[model samples]
Target: MLVAGTTRTAEIEGISAAGADSDLLVHTPSADAEILTYGEPIRAPVVPVSPSGCPTPAVVTRAVRELIGLDVTVVDGGLAEPTGAPTVTVGARPGDDVREQDPVSTAPGVLAAAREFGRAVPDDEVYLAETIPGGTTTAFGVLRALGETPTVSSSLPENPLELKQEVVRDGLTASSLEPGDAAGDPADALRRMGDPVLATITGLLVGLVEGDTAVTLAGGTQLLAAAALARHAGVETTLRLATTSFVAGDESVDLETAARALNVDLTVTDPGFENRDHPAMDAYVAGEAKEGVGMGGALALADAAGVPMEDVRERIVTVYDRLLDGRDPAEPQP
Candidate 1:
């Protein structure tokens, strides 16, 4: 089973280039969760896409889920709109911009709720995922608050490192925290500089740590931020991270170094989108909407299950074609 959380942070602008435009960005997370549970998004005619028309990674994740028969549970960490899929909500409101202090004022309560929610799950092994617009920026804020100079990735081909750094700096300054000020207190860092998704994921990881169930933190820098917080809060459990080759191959950031810093075992999967004929796949090869909604983890799991990448690609094409035509995929392709 995969537990995917959705959130929103106002710092998405100037840092992330996820949705097709500013108006669609806030709907990205909800649309992603809806697409994962149902075959298509209920709120919009098409799935969210990058500015270059690269479909949201939710298509990839949806393909893998149908191929492998994986069940998904959506977590409403904080959504700007409601998802058609049922959700376990941990937060009652969306997060404010990170540039302001106390972005997630209900951090402690949200964490506690997420911890309890995690403990209630019956699965022995789980894949954790997230769908948050501008999540990387908030992750950077939390990481910086905890004293780590993390080189996080962006949804766009160009990393926008300077913009992210500026956002983090403003967030820290507004929160009155210097780098490392919240080092020993992980939850405080989240409260001061993070989003509901970070707190929820951190608490979920911590809750799973106390049990025998194995957990894989899925996604790139965002998951790293959660794991870093979990460890800083004294979670001794070893974590496994899964992401796409796009993130691994990004020259603008050092993902491996950050994984090593958190002592996490990293796995990178390539869905072989290179040179694909589809418009969305073409944009993906060009480096847009690289990883989100657990695409990397779902791809890795499919590979382990002896599913061919070609099959996954075919499924994605089917989903994308239907999406473009304003229709649902009704059923998985054989």
Candidate 2:
């Protein structure tokens, strides 16, 4: 079984008012870290810089490659900054800021493309992951549209509940969509307040199910919304969700409750980064960059494959050290 995946950059990530700094501070380096690690050495990997110093995708991806020996298939759903990795371009326009306008206009086309890709996947089973910035807020919006009031998790330790709620409120108002209005119509809900990744992930799940392939959505709240959309679209396939203990530990949101509500089997991976010596790993314990680039899912898959948890921790720390080698701890460079 191979781990197949997609990547998208949403401009809703750029809205400072949304309280998501996924794209603002580090130039959204997770995209670079994700695919570049599978290719040549990234002479300059994009490292996340925040008050707590967020965890980089390179560590997580490095573990995936070393443990599973599968590379991610990048999909250009939409990007504010094009990833250094080669990508399949399925969308031309980046998502608009949901607070100002409908973020996703190409939902239908993206969904179609995702379904086609899913049908062609050579792997009998795939661990599907995504790298979309600001996806949680869009997840919150989509969940609300689906008649579910969900408190979604965030990369930042101090969850900006008020800011996310504010943005979702403005987005719903701009679209003239009241809560639960689009519950029966997943596409309409996506069109109203979702993003490219949500559409693509939902479509991928549906398509993979059609192909008789078992799929695991590897992320946090965003995957919950995608699974909800799949079920709403009449997909009865039992899908699994894998995320980190950090996300489950987030006091800001109840991911377990949300997953149970959606009828998605949830698995939480404990990488034990808290006991690691690396600062970046320490940041994860502190609640910065809790989950992204399918870190949690990859860990869960590695565990399922019988890779020792200690080995997983060692690889992540080694990668984190190499990526941050010789960099100034005081100044952050893009």
Candidate 3:
């Protein structure tokens, strides 16, 4: 179709109301990013800070879609039925299966669009891509609720058990609930967040794999969570795309843990980043980096896309700095 589903998280820590719509996602959209919403949101991701420590899905989707030249259709994707996104039929239920369009879960409106491109130009391999912010939080919530170990503990994870527990703890705290990390079943997690953008991406993964032309997952932790779900459901796939590889084993976001749960072979290029953001590094160390703002995953996607990493980094950091430090967002940067 035009492109895969384009999703943005709405999370503003201070005022949850801010995330009640796609405002937060639009807050940090890429230079070419567009804003498409139906009306308002109910429960969305909220990032109170201006620089938006996390990369909004709005920004990531716009950038990725621009690079690949795909039309973006924004869906509310709020907890309730969405009215913003284009109507794409996902003629299947949400479960653990590498389903083709013939039978799949949560299909984006664009899949049918992409498939047509394939038919017209069968020679060229075309597929879907996605971006969702604040998804890792949902992942943690899902796994912990499912009673499985979550792997995204630290901004950098070393031990999965500890990491999973930590993520569970944070999620529990954020939701103002008691800490729980008991691995029992997946239904709990799925009921809580399985239907999120993660579900859509997993659907994309299966949708692309069964037919032809590999799919490229364009974000981090959330991709790992989706991959893990695929593995757990016994979906067989070999993510051949470089972007796919980057998500399966990234230490930065518990990709391995997510993959382990999924039981698939989603490999990644090592040391995913060619350059380091000392300032961001300092922020993480200073305990400032928040999940779902989308810096690491955006950087990873930039890497997979072969773009100048600094340009992407500068856009994010500069935009954020100007917005947060009371500088004019319209002012030019040095």
Candidate 4:
């Protein structure tokens, strides 16, 4: 199973089915392996040199090629280069300005595409992940709108916590003002601020389902958000939480909390991140990331694709280990 969309600085996470050692594994496609990438500046303030998008591309591509033992195809869906070399060049900077449509429509489009792909895949199962930067904030926004205190921040709730506070307030304010204009459409919001990848993911999911492959969504907050939306909209899917991501702190997004809200059982893959050497866990402490929605999802797909869990774990451990070794990708790039 493979699914990847929604990435931010570092693309820290991908997707997953469960935490550690689950039956059906999940994973996400890397930018290098993606059919393509797309996005437009939505006036959201972004930082320079912050390393945007998921970090799984190199790992996922490497792991898939080595573990799954195949040279996967890579394609572009129009927005090949959006004035940014990966999300690292233009960071979302954790703010409300970064917008993505509700994905109500986009989800269907992605699902449609995914359904088709699912039938083509040799496996009978499928997994999904997201690549939305600042997607955590959006998840908080959606959750809060649904009337859940999903976040708690000491400094006004932290990055996404604060972001959610603002968004929820704005959404509430908008609803109060409009009182009838559908308040706001997540799809429109995504279109205005969301990257093209979001739509692509949804389309893939839709297509895969049409193909008859059993589906398990993988990702941290975004997947949860998408699952909630899909379920509410009558989209049938088996949901799983890729437990390997450090994208969301337990305090901020328990996912369990979100699942309870929807009255759904969230299956998970592996709990490998519990190891002291896990890079994702360290990323959170380093303040580089606060959620693993994407990471969780990506790992799941890797597992399903038959990538050895040890190899996946080793790859992540090494990536961060490499970083700690002072070997930066930006070492002059000579």
Candidate 5:
């Protein structure tokens, strides 16, 4: 099962290049979760795309899930808009700017509730993913608070490293935290610098591990931040971090190094999008919208299931074309 968590942090200007319209960035997560669950966005008029017209990674995720028959659960970690897709509510409000104090004041309660939900999941192995806009900034903040100097991944081809650094620096100062201040207290980091999605995933990881459920964290830096938090909280269980080669190949951030620092096993999958004729696939090759909505993990699972990379790329094109036409290609035209 893939659990997708949505947050409002994506609304931060110049922070995320996830959506074409800056105003719709908050809805990207909802729209992503919707597409992952239903093959097309139900609330938004169209599927989320980058400013460059590159499709959201959720398209890739949806195709993989269809081919591999993976189930998905959306979590309302904090949503500005209610998703038409079914979701699990974890008692969290939408996160505020991390530069503000108490960005996720309800984080403790959210963590506890999500832990219960994680324990109740029947799946022995769960794949945790996220869809927050500006997530890399929050991930950076959380990691810094936990004493790690992380180069977080971005959805854009060129990561806005300077802007993210400024944001994290201000956030830490605003919260009166120095690097590693929350090292011994992971929840404290969530209360100040983290988003609800981070808290939810960390809690879920702990609960899932305690329940003896094998788990794979499916994303790049965001999942790595959650893993770092879980480790600080004393979760010694072996965990796997899975992502697409786009993220691994990104020179803007070092995912492999962070994974090693966190001591989590890392798996990177090349979905063979580069060879596709589709513009959406080409966008991935060009380094736009690198990874999110469990795209990387979906690809890894597809590989493990022996699904050919060519087949996966073909399905991605099918899904993208379906979204483009606003209907499945398999459906008869009027």
Candidate 6:
């Protein structure tokens, strides 16, 4: 399941300091990521923009769909724009920035929707991914509410830990939630500070476990927050966290440590973008737009399905080039 949502926190100035264009920055958390994951212009009429200038979620998702034939189910936790792809809408309002107010106003309804969606998933094993801007800060807040002192990753070359810490601190204060106060109640923690996507994923994982389905959460610290919530909710089915090597190698956050603390299995996909001859891929090496829309998990699944890493890299570049040049992939290059 590819879960897409938005948190108003991205609108806060300086919250997200890097992206290719200002419009891209705003759209990253909007329906643009979902449109990109669909691998063509839909509902937005243009490719999603990224500061990294190369790899977007669309490229990775398109690669997986073509190479491994993985079916994508998009779930809209809350989107500023509706996706052209069919989606299961769960929330009526976009999440507020926790720093300004309680972010999840309809946590219960969203959770219920997620539970129903999870139960209805026909696949025995599901790969879950997400695209939520300003997610790392929300994840940090949720972690703190759950009594974990976590350092979260970011899309910038330099992870703005201090800024995120300030935002999280403000959020905790505004919500009157002290550290560890919501630790025993994951849902309450989510209500206090998480986005709809986080809450939905938590409920979805629980429901999936109840329905005897295995799940792989494919993202970074945001998914880690979901895993922690799932464990707190007493989910015990097969579960793991998968993300890109950029996140795993990030010095600003200790994802492996956090995963271990939550007792969640963790895996990282090394797509060898560092050796690729593409600016977008190179930007990944430089720590920009490191992971989103389940790129890492999709790559890992493709590799497990016996797709060559080189072929996967080539597909990504091909898709990215097409989007960058605003031309169809089949058109001859000038």
TM-score winner among the candidates?
Answer: 5
Q: Which ten residues in a row have the lowest lDDT in candidate 2?
A: 1-10
What is the alpha-carbon RMSD of candidate 4 to the true structure?
Answer: 9.7
Tens digits of per-residue lDDT, candidate 4, 184-223, equal 3433333333333443444445555556766555555555
Single out the weakest 10-residue window by summed lDDT for candidate 4.
Answer: 17-26
Note the clash tally of each candidate.
0, 0, 24, 90, 1, 3
Q: If the candidates were sorted by their TM-score against the true structure, best first, what order would they fall in?
A: 5, 1, 6, 2, 4, 3
How far is 159's C-alpha from truth in model 4 (Å)? 4.1
lDDT of 5 at 254: 76
Which candidate wins on lDDT?
5
Model 6, 205-300: lDDT tens digits are: 887877778889988888888888887777755469889888899988877777877778888988887778676477778778778888878878
- Please report, in order, the local distance difference test score of every candidate based on alpha carbons: 0.80, 0.68, 0.37, 0.39, 0.83, 0.74
Q: How accurate is candidate 3 locally (lDDT)?
A: 0.37
What are the C-alpha RMSDs, in order, of all predicted structures?
3.6, 3.6, 9.5, 9.7, 3.2, 3.5
Q: Lowest-lDDT window of 10 residues in candidate 5?
A: 325-334
lDDT of 6: 0.74
220-276: candidate 1 lDDT, tens digit per residue: 888888899988889876799999998888888788998888899999999898847
Question: How well does candidate 4 score on lDDT at residue 247?
Answer: 42
Candidate scoring better on lDDT of 5 and 6? 5
Tell me the tens digit of each residue's lDDT in model 5 across 1-334: 4444444456667778777766767677777888899998777555678777788899998998889889888887777766788988888788888889789998899888888888887887889998887888888888889887776889888898888888889999999999999996788898898888888888888888888788999998888899998998899877899999999999987777778877899999998876766877888888888898888899999999999999898898888888877543222223
Off by over 4 Å in 6: 17-23, 29-37, 52-54, 326-334
Encode model 3's per-residue lDDT on 1-334: one tens digit a residue: 2122222222323211212234543322222122212111212222222242422333333343334344443322222322223534433222221111111223333233333333333322432333333444456555554455565432222323443345445545543443243223232344333433455545455545555654544344555555555444445665422232333434455555454555534434332223555332233333332233223333455566787645554454543443325433233212
TM-score of each: 0.94, 0.87, 0.50, 0.57, 0.94, 0.92
